[model samples]
Target: MRNFVVSFVIIFLGFTLAIVYHNNNKNNMVKAFAITLSLLKPTDDKSVILINSTIISDFFKKYPDLKKYKSDVSALYKNRNYKSIWYDRKGVIEFASLLYSKANLLNEEGIESNLAYKDKIDGIFGKKSTDKLSPTDTELQLSSLYIFYSKKVFQGIDTKKIRETGWFLPRKNLSYKNLLDSLLINPQLLSKNEKQLFGQYYKLREALKKYRLIEKNGDWNPITTDLLPKEYKLGDSSKTIGQIRQRLAVIGDLKQNSKSNLYDKELMAGVLNYKKRNSMKMDYSINSMLIQRMNTPIEKHIKAIIVNMERCRWIAPEMTKADEYIIINVPSFKLIFKRNSKKELDSDVFVGETMNETVIISSNVTQIVFSPYWNVPNSIIENELIPAISREKNYLEAHNMEWKNGKIRQKPGKKNALGLVKFIFPNADGIYLHDTPSKSLFQSEYRAYSHGCINMSKAKELALLLLKDNPDWPIERIDNAMKGEKETVCILKKKIPIHIVYFTAWANDSGEISFYNDVYERDSRLAELLISDDSK
Candidate 1:
């Protein structure tokens, strides 16, 4: 009787164990199927039926790095009545995918700063991400992402810091809250929101893509300088010529690399195009300096492209709306005059040297002074004139300068430092565009010789363009005023907007990009600030 009772207990325990194992397997299968179903569904509006408001606060508490956007996230949800914008019952929404892709491409947008909580954000889309985030967590993640992208790409670095980067252009005032609302409604504007950015930003972004590809391919090989001669002219042949040809083809200056050692016509054409784009003297001769410029690492070019893209973000789209405007790119040493969105004139210009950097500011050209007297600034007089006077007692008399009310001023004449014309725009910096007596300076490839003012190579042409339509100032009268007999001022009937900007890299809509020398050495400074706090 005891043996039979033991056998019965053992059989019952084995049967119970089998049932428990079967149930556990069935439960896991059900959980996996539920996750799959959530992903397959088109849209489940009820998933966010009513998220708990405390979840928003809890999420931020857990991810304090994103806390800066907490208010924005909260306000966004409140505007949506706490419904999940980034999701429905079907898991993350389709729009969420687009936002995710854009966030991952911040570098393409010229932003070095990474989104806070990047790993968690990545986990939301990971293969194991399904069923990981509650609806509220996913919602908050995307809201913060939108704000981060909008602020960094559309608005740029913080206001105070951007100002510190020496950019004084009017910044675009974007409302991320309102922008989110529009994006949610249309979704396509997320990609086509050119109205929110300066027109040039898109151009630079395209250049960045090309340069990054070049960098990835490792096409930029520094030429073997010691092996080559000092210069190569037409018909000259060397291994260095082949290297330069390869470089030019890589950058689209040449149609293709003939891989020839001879400096033929094809290579000369490429060299001329390269020189024009690089702000170099347009010549066919390949010199050591030109080869050195060609040898600049592709990485530096990429950085320059990225740096200029940041500059584009700081500009307002409306700044380009004016029918007539003037843009003086300091690094390019060129001034552009546009009327009705067409190029009216393009002229060479010389800006301040490193010691006296020209101020980057925008104002209206309200006045023009013909044969303007040069009222030398106190700084110049103390730093330059006093020493000259000590060397030569009659220096002021010889230079056509005299004391006026205890201040020395150069009299208006052919030899006056300000030449025959000047364009004035009101600003505290006292910087303006004017003519220079030294016409030969503009011929130089690198022309930073002024003292905090722009020396226009075509000042007379610009003055004539500005006064052409005015009946009061005819061609002959304008000509007479520019003869240096006396100073004459013309108040403009319509004020033309002038923006003096600094950009080492500039691009056009036609897919052409030009890299100029960093005259003020501002690119590295701005680049450092861009990546300084990215780890945080």
Candidate 2:
């Protein structure tokens, strides 16, 4: 009887162990079938979905611990919206909790999306409720990473160096306040693509520094250009001025002249045009002025070019209105006005001479006075008058000039220095647009005939437009202003901004560069500095 009872217990235990083994094997088979189904994609779809009973069996086998939690990830598969990551919405919440373990790193906006909070298990990781308006940190970092990399790649900022400098050296730590103040409300300066806001990453300190020597001295000399050592490359080309002249000599545009003092008109004009294009004067001579540009350190010029490139990037590509605005190429001594982005007016302008060079400026026009009085500057008296007075006491009266209270003034009339008209705009520099009696001087290719003011070739058209807004203005009225009369002031209803600048060398719209004479003698000074290393 004892043997029979032991056998019965053993048989029952054996049957139970077999059943457990069978069940375990069946569950594993279901999981394997679910995973295998992924390899056999539907003919019409990019991925395969398992709709058999194996999916549920596999779901339990793979995520056996889900029952202990409040949710199951099988729902993602059911919804057919599983992302690339194996983690579903619930898993994302759990993972995020581990990331923001730091307390107070974020505010109320952060808590709703906190993955660590058990209350958000059923809630989707990135699903927005009425309270949340933005993505979670995970999404934000991922999306912004692309933008950050793209910006770094496009701008070519040395990211490795930037990162090594604590990530703030070149971006956040800028002299933004001073630059903002200096710009004085030109919002575009700051509106540029946020990359250069950290006080231009490059430096043009030497180039500007070398060029400014002329600003103080009014001309380039050995002290500024020739004495310094510099090497510059325009754009991507590596040819130097000497190398370029050699190449051009083959074409006869330049003669193979090597003396520092000697330069032909073709070489001279080319250098001048470069200056003009670069916002220097078109002196139309390759003297000291040409040397300045040629000698500026390449690094400094690169910085300046980068800065201007950023500036141009900020400007709107399209015109705002269908109106007229004129751009005077000071170095080239040319003016162009666009109407609806089309060239409506074009003319030549006589810029300031080197001794009394025109200041670079921009302002709106207030009026145009035709046949206006010439208020002789004291410099004229000191330079031209005192010398003339020393020669002939009657010279002042012959020139219609008078002195009162130590001030010299010229009255309007035929042979008056101001000629038929003077276009007026009040500025600190006392510069204006006007016509000159020396119209014959315009025939010369080099036209610098002003004392820090602009002389327009088509001053008559400017007069007509100044009076266009004035309903009462007529030709007779203009003629009266032109007739050897006293000073007349014609106020403009709509003022225009006039920019007097200097640029000597510029590539034309047709891609061919137009060079000018270096009237200011700045090129030679700059070039000397550039070749200072080479010459030495």
Candidate 3:
């Protein structure tokens, strides 16, 4: 970080001096370039400023005509106002030095700001969500963001905040520093790169206002114990406020096991429930985790939300005013179908299990295959099928599936592995919508249990919606496809957009957030890295 910062300052100052010298003279491009080279040559700070004598003569030699590109560089350097500009930059740094009393500064991919805060800058100390971001934070974040972008992700003007559908595969040890270093080395410029870069330097200070790059490393541990009390009790009305504080610290059994003990069972229960709902254990033990959650001043949560808001910005906007669209939240184990701005179908879904936790991916539903054949995944083939086949040769025929390319292929029938139907969505994640035979598995709270395909409980409804635009032909056609001897595909009248996302915390239309368990354990991991010691 120090090396990069030093190099950046030198490069910026070098260009400023060069342009100033040439503006006063007719032809001093080489001299200006040479002066910048000299700045790079010496390690001493005084030596750099010593070149002023050479610059003055060079400037007089070439006058105003050469100064055309001056303002484009640094305003002060361009207008011959270096002293003022230098002082301004110096003052800003000094202000930061005094302000940073003791804050954590970390940069881990898994780190995230506290999820329950919004800072109170000028306003009264209270909770509030603002419209925009911090100009300083945005400016600070851009340097790392662009560096990461140039290296790791493909460059493109995502129409809007978009999801990186499907699981991300790594080429090496996946660490925060490793990723940042990779991005710094890989300089990928997104479309419309020129304007974005040239203008960023001018508004660098202000841009920080638009983003929440700095998050409170407040006290909250998602994985640890952070239970809230469900009830509380009071008996001595004469106790002073200070006395109550001292007594409260020692009172452990909030339930009031005995009549003499002043306790609130209900309050303890409610608090425990809140903790459980937010992914904490239900033990009602306010350990380090609970302490952390309490200290997470509201300002922090707001910032975390804004950073995530950028993810949405990367996606191009879209409208689904027509027929219903299906959204399967991979992390939440739920599927939603909406129409006319209202939810028509919502159901629990069983996704890939622990060992087979589903990968994040997306695609459009082109068609639904009724009474479909199930071509088993290779994992199942090697692990389950081979063992069964070794035990009994007739096992393969009893299931109606045949061997193809060393795979256990189940034929379309009542006993087919795909259950009764399969929804195909062409996606890079190799994921799709389908039905499952293990219906009982849906009852489990932990629903990651597939070979990556989403097992939909309302497969029939989704199928009908897919073909809602089709005239005349309807659900009966789908019934016939099942009865027919050959496996059939019901083509949709039009292609439908299917978004498979992984949002663990999101507000509904009422602006009240409903958080689900992070079954994939992604939330805690992301939160940690995002809140590393690099920036607290």
Candidate 4:
């Protein structure tokens, strides 16, 4: 009886302990589950709402058409700790609506394509219907739309295609995740954030609108010269002059069209203005070429503006933020030097000929060589030099060239092909900026005369300005160095950024647009890629 009582008591104690342990374990599990659920839910701060990542994965699976943006969407959500950015306690956020509107009007941004899942996206904001998506579906759809819109408007086309277009300048790398965060805080940035885009983009967009309006309002008739003189100048009278006057007036080159046939002083002023805008010599003469330029249809002009705007999309606004830089527009045959955001110099430049096209690139002007020797490229040697030598044995001696290390190099002198000075910016293509002995070429309206390197008309002036801040070099020394007696090299203490760009259309600060001839026939090719839905 004693042994039985002891065994029963021990069993009872063991059973009580087991029950306590089980209850404690269940309570701990319940507490842990409650904490995890809290983490997955919206916190006291409305902006800190969390979301289940599984929903995002499911969303992409259902909408495979929008899967292109799935990675970007996932990164955006993960950046906010799996938060729902496109939504709040309300069904949809105001910025989401703004983004949807932007996506709808991609045409205004020079984009011609329908967004992915357009019908589903439209249904999100449309009137109530059976096709209305769930709250989660609506949120994911809006996020995908925002990515599409940003890629089209801010980023232009893909990098691979842009590189294929022959634009090698550094492209903009924007973080849309952070961009969205800022937009959510201050939605005004959605419209006023010019910093996010190249400044020229906005200018070109305004020009596009103006040209489209002109096309819509019955474009001006083409000027005909069938029975008129080949050229029209001041005091020249013809029916063609009346047509020219009307043409100039249509594009704001002339304040008003006089409706008179005689070419009067007003018409001469208009002609000069027209010539200036078209990158022609600012003179009172109008010829077949000027008339041909004027004959370009409004549709072509709109396409050119759109093409340039697309090019602008590839550039970043921060590129121009440097303290000093040089912008060489190959089509315009002009070089713009800016320091502290002010135009320091505007000089004439001649780029490469058609067969040897100048490459669009960016680099730093590292050194300036005075009285530099011309190391003729191997292609030129093989093509021209060997043949010239075969024709005349005295060709090399007469040109002050000699075989150095089995390669031909012209001695530094007045007769040197690369005139008195050369600005060296290291590049793989072996191209640089230098003065040319052929000063007469700069006088020509079309200055595509170089082999590949740029020939600056004001090379000496540029050297002086670039070295002005350096105490080691001054105006007197620079002039002495250009006398062509021997080679003198000056490595710049501070390198200046130089960008050789190809822009056939540009808008001035006054919003007046100027058009240049497509020197390399790049506009049409780029335009085709820009407009093609497949390229996008």
User: In model 4, what is the error at residue 526, expressed in angstroms?
Assistant: 1.6
Question: Which lDDT tens digits does candidate 1 get at residues 356-449?
Answer: 8888888999999999999999998999999999999999999999999989999999999889999999988898899988999988999999
Question: For every model shown, what is its TM-score relative to the native structure?
Answer: 0.87, 0.44, 0.49, 0.90
Worst 10 residues of 4 by lDDT: 41-50
lDDT of 4 at 102: 74
Compared with the true structure, what per-residue lDDT tens digits does model 2 show for residues 140-218? 2221222222222123233343232111112222232233233333433322323432222112222334334433554
Q: In candidate 3, which residue ranges exceed 4 Å CA deviation?
A: 1-324, 404-407, 483-485, 528-536
Candidate 3 residues 297-391, lDDT tens each?
A: 33544434423333332332332344656777775678888876688788678787667767654456787788887878787888998899899
Worst 10 residues of 1 by lDDT: 40-49
RMSD (Cα, Å) for all candidates, in order, is 10.5, 19.6, 16.1, 8.3
What is candidate 1's local distance difference test score? 0.84
| Candidate lDDT values, in order | 0.84, 0.47, 0.47, 0.84
The C-alpha stretches of model 4 lying farther than 4 A from their native spots are 1-50, 127-130, 533-536
Tell me model 4's lDDT, rounded to 2 decimals. Answer: 0.84
Model 2 lowest lDDT segment of ten: 104-113
Number of backbone collisions per candidate:
1, 53, 91, 0
In the predicted model 1, the residue pairs found to clash are 44-89
Error of 1 at 336 (Å): 0.4
Ranking by TM-score: 4, 1, 3, 2
